[model samples]
Target: EIVAAVESVLAPQRAGRLAGRKVLVTAGPTHEPIDPVRYIANRSSGRQGFAIAAAAAEEGADVVLVSGPVSLADPPGVNVVRVETAREMMAAVESALPVDAAVMTAAVADWRTEADSGHKIKKDGSGRPPALVLVENPDILATLGHHPSARPKLLVGFAAETDDLIANARAKLDRKGCDWIVANDVNPETGNMGGAFNTVRIVSRAGIEEWPRLAKEDVARRLVGRIADHFAGA
Candidate 1:
């Protein structure tokens, strides 16, 4: 049954379309520590990114996954590097160089505490909440897209938005210097942020392609297929 399932999952790509391509993927939410026991993070389950990685692997790409803190098993035939903080994630990604494509799927924390207290901070008798200093984290997508060395030929980034989805996604694609931006509305009612299904638009310099709502795994397969087509045409 397991073998049959695997065959069904990969049957569409029996042509070995991406046979020897190298792809890198980032997943999960970076945990920014405030203290020994406290941290800040986003609501990314890493399922979408993991699914993409698996699809790419099944298409015959040599895959490298630089994942943030997530409790998931590594997919078969893919290299997995587990990391926690944003800084660590960035470092791991930079080290895994010279790939054909990169997918920035991780919902990285935009900011982190400026001063990470090594010791646990305790409340004083004043009954007032303590203040926190915030610092911006490096935009991993922008960093990799504009890297001086070993920049991937095709770079993809995700734009999770609540309003002005297409406009904001276009802006991000321009700002981040990535080849493609996958935009999705993550309104709480839509249940997209950590849900099994998604509805998204793929924005590029050419134009926007609105994809149908589908399971995350299906989305991954379609995106991987597009990536394979991109390389073939390039």
Candidate 2:
């Protein structure tokens, strides 16, 4: 009992398989500004990503959570960096680089206004709407996956698709050059986008491993366990 107590006191976080490892997580929905008053955003509540960060931290991993605009509280034992736009999120993710693993779960807007309007535009009684040119946002996951020197050892990407779920995930795994892709259906009917429960599948070179519908927290724990297994050569 004395020895155990002493060990616990000394290495409280070292009891898990991910001890001494660093993990990166990106979460929430990046808002791309159209004007000073409005921006393009998604329905992502950042629940799954936050849960993943918490799970990773619980497993003794040094977790860096680069989150977008979200109302979620910072997970205990995690270094949280909050950003509003996709560019900002990309910068934050890059700054936390050289991690052992990364999970890109943030729902980043695909495009943004080419230029932010300094002020909100008012209707001039014309029947036509304003024309806002848009440009593609930086692809954070693909950038890291194709990084020349700083790619994570185990890069994982998430695919939240409404259709062609497995096919899209497989394509993303190849296109993103990531080790694994976690695919889920967010077809509005599934309620997985901003809900507490999730159903996901692990898509990898090995094959697909489907998981039962579970609470977001449980999904996070199981995913972290899989990550630990991969590191431990299970």
User: Which structure among the candidates has the greatest lDDT?
Assistant: 2
> What would the TM-scores of all predictions be?
0.92, 0.94
Pairs with steric clashes in candidate 2: none
For model 1, the superposed segments whose C-alpha errors exceed 4 Å read 1-15
Candidate 2 C-alpha lDDT tens digits along 100-159: 999999999989999999899777789788888999999999999999999999999999
Tell me the deviation in Å of residue 223 in model 2: 0.4
Total backbone clashes of model 1? 0
Please write out the lDDT profile of model 1 over residues 1-234, one tens digit for every residue: 999999988775434678778899999999999999999998899989999999999998889999998878898888999999899989998888888999989999999999999999899989998899999998889998788987899999999999999999999998999999999889999988889999999999999999999999999999999999999895
Model 2 C-alpha lDDT versus the unseen true structure? 0.94
Model 1: how far is 232 from its true place, Å?
0.6
- Top candidate by TM-score: 2
